[model samples]
Target: MNVKTEVKQIGLYINGKYVPSSSHRTFEVKNPATQGVIALVSEATEEDVNQACLAAREAFENGPWRTMSVAERCEKLRRMAEIILERKEEIAGLDAIDVGKPYHSTVQHEVPRAAHNIHFFADFVQMQGGETYPMEENFVNYTRYEPVGVAALITPWNVPFMLTTWKLGPCLAAGNTAVIKPAEMTPLSVSLLGEIAKEAGIPDGVVNVVHGLGSVVGTALTEHPAVDLVSFTGSTATGKRIMKNGADTLKKVSFELGGKAANIIFEDADLDKAIPGSIHAAFMNSGQVCLAGSRILVQRSIFAEFLERFTKAAMELKVGDPQNIDTKMGPLVSEQHYQKVTSYLEIAKEEKAKLICGGKRPELPEYLQKGYYLEPTVYVQENPKSRICQEEIFGPVVTLIPFDTEEEAIQIANDTEYGLNGVVWTENLQRAHRMSHSVRAGTIWVNCWFVRDLRAPFGGFKKSGVGREGGHHSLEFFTEAKNICIALK
Candidate 1:
């Protein structure tokens, strides 16, 4: 199944078409589950990025796409969704190879949801428009939710298919053109999306994909003066850099950055739900996710019991190849990530935290030796200031800290500088709502963890980065208001 035999096995997608990079340089897409070269993708240089940017600008300002009405755009977007559903296999296979998600999840979840995302945005594009305000004077007053010229969308590799749709859906729905760069580590899935967009009858220059090192293409996308807005999803450190870069152009920026989400387990939480939900929150996506519940805050009354049940669940997760439908845990994204995660394990020991269960490699198939495998790990830290408790330990690792009072637990949860998300586990409704509000994160879950509705806003406060994504926030990112008035007799 050398699907790479297809036209863009690895190439830049610009003007609604795939083409080889002007810079002969290219990079290998690795299979995180196997650590093999999945495919060779074209690596765009700074110049190539400018080319994409120019095309997006031309499209936004003067091309046929710019003049297209909301009804026209929706028709094309809906057609793209239909094409995506028809090409779901190709898209799913690309995602699996590019990022090592399980085949079943790729085909069943990522591809289908992405198509619906396109359709979802298409459904609303026609309905969303500018507003008119009534004024006492004789002047006509109106406002438009107009496009913000060229948009630069940079997505991470963790959930490439899902988040690309998250960013692109609203950008397109609001009539903005884009130059999108999926993370270098997992560009294929979104590249496959490029093909679907072309097949869907979208005119050239509306959407462009440039796959390359972020240092080169990413820098160009964020800082390009032609880019009117930037939408990014990644670490806080990088988000800061992008923000600084966008400032040079005084460009609008929307970021979905880092998280060290707090997962609280109170004395009265139902152990059955709390136990499994905590494990799913911390270890889903092998804990490579940004919004993972990596910091576990437990009430002193149930700390020991929660740790016991939580560690038990962590140890039982099936650590094996992603291709296996039965495997609950897959490899981390890459060797770099694998090393980063393992080093944190050593950090826990040096910091003198109590290692609960599975902390090292799993003795699985010999082939996994070449992959980025990590067993689930949980630790009990003495305090909230522990380095592991504060940092984004982006792996199957979590630090559990105990607090006596509800007030203390809330304080501990809000202790981190990264207030991206949090989880509140309690049986009492009033207590759950209070605790959720008390936590400083942007989005809080009560009696649940890691669930999302696209219609809701998603982002963070403080160092977690600025602005928001999903729902109306996304459309707003792609729009800017302009006021015009004239004196009349």
Candidate 2:
């Protein structure tokens, strides 16, 4: 497929206007697939971030959004979802180019999921209600949830559009205005939200976006006094920093952080499903996903067979231009990230792990040669405590460790500091139940990977994150509950 390499200028969307940064500075956003400058985005300074927070604060304090009826608010959310679906192709294209995600996956999966998030939350909020208590005949008590006010939403580069909507949906549904700082590496697709919000009849200053490096822009937003809540999705290290930054003001903070999830395959597992599912679990989005099951634990009985099939499948993944429909994997998001991921190859060698399939960059066409592409890598390690097994490489890398029994599998899986996500592949119902309960993670998948329901609580247990945000959990985080009692005559 022929892809356009048009260069556009993206500005900070503050209040209701698309304006340049206060410093009049801009940064280049390059396409990871072509190494070409796709856009020049505004570099938000502290002043720019403050303006966005002030805009959100002003809108939340005085605008009609907070006072709008639940039905009316939902209508606007539905309209935003509609616009997202209508421009799905355009938005998907931007993300594919900006984040180096496969266009097929973005257009067919992530974009639609982004729209679904808005729709689901809009519908969910309408059915949501508070508790009513009747104490005796003399008095009655009831609770109500109110918008918290200005929210600072910090999103990551991988799956930027979908994750932004994931946070934005509940924030807006609860009637809170927001200032968003999309990952500077992949800011193009999220830059469309400002226009989407306006066209959907959302009031000005209700949803503002500022783009810049996280150190400057993210810290400013988190530390802003006017901001009521901070919802962030990124590295665990950054999540910790945001916590400290917001500590002075005691801002309500929710984070969905990093993971090194364990995908365990029991001997009773169905390899037909496990092989492909495990491949997707490990290498989806070039393994840039926070939920990527980078550790695969196979029962020793089927270890050799699983290794053969898994390595073969990993080698067959198509790595090239993200615009190509057949391309299953694309380049890492940036040169810096490419370097970070490739460093793990050296780490694997230093750890004395067996190199199973891939650990080098693939030979691409002349145009894509300059892109940040790497082959999907797999390794077999005897020691589960190796650095390659413990740390999050955040790339297309997986470490396979052999285990003897379910007890050992559980032990190895829980050994990591991260408890974000895990996968259990087995047909035995009893074992599945046992493993599900034994694994120390937020969400455990049984014979499935990446399948989600909007109603379930989504967050990590340990170092993965601080709080949960999905369904009622999301509403709980975005709103403040108050109780009012009345005395009967």
Candidate 3:
């Protein structure tokens, strides 16, 4: 595949216009699959982030967006969904090239999911209603939900576009204005949302996107007094920093952070389904997912057989050009991330864990030789407390551990500090139910992986995250509730 070295210019979108940064500073965004410059994006200064926050604040407080009828608001959101689908291919391609995700996966799954997120939230806000309480004859009290003012949405590089929409949908649906700071590495697709919002007839300043580094832009946004609340998705350490930044202003903070999820297969499990499902759980998006099951636990009865089949399946995955439809995996999002992931191979060896299948870059065409490509890696570690088993590698890596009993499996799964997501595979109905409840993570999957319902509350426990989003949980986080009382004459 021929890689494009042409650099497209991208700018900050504030107050309904695309403009260069106040300082006119720019940064290069590289294609991880080719190590070539894909775009030169405007780097937001603290002043630029302040401008975006002020614009969002003004919009939420004085614009017609909040005063618009519910029907009109929903219609505009629905239109945003429509435009997202209409331009799905273009958007998907940008993400594929910028984030090094497979084009097919981005188009087929992430793009549609982004559209669905907007559509679902648009409809959900309409059906949502306040609660009423009847006092003793003389008076009645009722609760009304009002939108929180300005929101600062800080999204991660992995699955950038989809996650941005995931936050944008609820924030806008509830009448809040936004200042989004997408991850600097994959800003291409998300920068297009400013135009999408404008074309959908959303009012000016209601949606603002600033492209820049986290230290400057992200810090300013989180600490900005004009920003009412922050919804962030990224590393746990960053989440804590945002919390501290918001402390002075007492900003409401919701975070979806790191994870080292566990996927357990019991002796009674069907290997046919478990093997492939486990593969998808661990290696999806090259294992950059927050919910990636990096820890795989198999019962002693089937450990050897499961490892053999799983290793072969993982080894067969095609890792190359993101543009290729048959490519199952792509490079890490950037050279820095590639280095971070590869460092774990050394950590695994130092921990005395045995490498079961892969840990090296694969042989590819000369065109892709410079790409940050690594084979799907599997390891066997007897110590559940090993760094390879406990920490998140955030790459195409999985550590296999064998357990003799269901009780031991649960113990091994719950040993991690992360409680984001987990999986249990078993034929015994009783055992499945027991394991699901025993796992400490949020959103445990029984005989499945990544099946999500928009209505369910989605967030992590422990170090994974702080609050929940999705369905009414999103509404709760994005809005403030007030009780109104009336006296009867």
The residue pairs that clash in candidate 2, if any, are none
Model 2 ranges with Cα > 4 A deviation: none
| lDDT at position 414, candidate 1 | 84
- Model 2, span 141-190: residue lDDT tens: 99999999999999999989999999999999999999999999999989
Q: Give the candidates in order of lDDT, highest first.
A: 2, 3, 1
Ranking by TM-score: 2, 3, 1
Worst 10 residues of 1 by lDDT: 1-10
- The reply for model 1, stretches above 4 Å from the true place, is 1-8, 484-489
Candidate 3 residue-wise lDDT, 297-410, digit = tens? 988888899999999999999988999989999988878888999999999989999998889999989978888999999999999999889888999999999999989998
lDDT accuracy of residue 246 in candidate 1? 84
Which candidate should be chosen as best, given lDDT against the real structure?
2
CA lDDT, every model vs. true structure: 0.83, 0.94, 0.93
Residue-pair clash count for candidate 1: 1
TM-score for predicted model 2 compared with the true structure: 0.99
lDDT of 1 by residue, 100-173 (tens): 66667677887888888888888866766666665668666677777789989899998898789888888888
Candidate 3 deviant stretches above 4 angstroms: 1-5
